[model samples]
Target: MTKRSRRTHSAGLKAKVALAALKGEKTLAELAQQYDVHPSQITAWKQQLVEHAADLFGGGK
Candidate 1:
């Protein structure tokens, strides 16, 4: 039996992937394969980016 180890991604990497997703230039599956992350994770990151986009414009202090 083989066990999978947990992988940790840096904030910068997450942001990069999320931005790629936002660009809509590639499918989520393609992004996942290129980034070596799960599609679901990419989806979550995209959602987070969308939800927090206003924060970048002084919405949050």
Candidate 2:
């Protein structure tokens, strides 16, 4: 089996995946398959989104 190269995801893509996870419209496994990302990564992004969501409202400071 060939090892896959590491991939870098853009902020926009990360945000998109994170938002989808937050929506609860799909299971993590389903999202992972659709996005070609690991469920743990999606969970991490979702956590970051939830943690920093206030930053969008200028509450980051």
Candidate 3:
């Protein structure tokens, strides 16, 4: 069996995936399959988005 190489995702894709996760329109497994990413990674991205969302509005101060 050939080993899979580690892939890097762009920031735009990460934001899109995280936004999709936050929409609650689909399950994590579905999102993972669609985006070719692990559900745990999606969860982490979603969490990161939620945690830092306030910073976008200058509310982090």
Best by TM-score: 2
Off by over 4 Å in 2: none
For model 3, give the RMSD to the true fold.
1.3
Of 1 and 2, the candidate ahead on TM-score is 2
Positional deviation of residue 41's Cα in model 2 after best superposition, in angstroms: 0.3
**If both were scored by TM-score, which would come out higher, candidate 2 or candidate 3?**
2
lDDT of 3 by residue, 1-61 (tens): 9998999999899999999999999999999999999999999999999999999899777
Top of the candidates by lDDT:
2
Q: Considering lDDT, where higher is better, how would the candidates rank from best to worst? A: 2, 1, 3
Candidate 3: deviation at residue 38, Å?
Answer: 0.5
Model 1 over residues 1-51: C-alpha lDDT tens digits? 999799899989999999999999999999999999999999999999999
Q: Candidates' lDDT values, in order?
A: 0.95, 0.98, 0.95
Q: Positional deviation of 13 in candidate 1, in angstroms? A: 0.5
> Which lDDT tens digits does candidate 2 get at residues 1-61?
9999999999999999999999999999999999999999999999999999989998778
Candidate 2 local distance difference test against the native: 0.98
Error of 1 at 50 (Å): 0.6
lDDT of 3 at 59: 70
Please give the distance, in angstroms, between residue 61's alpha carbon in candidate 2 and its true position after superposition.
Answer: 1.9
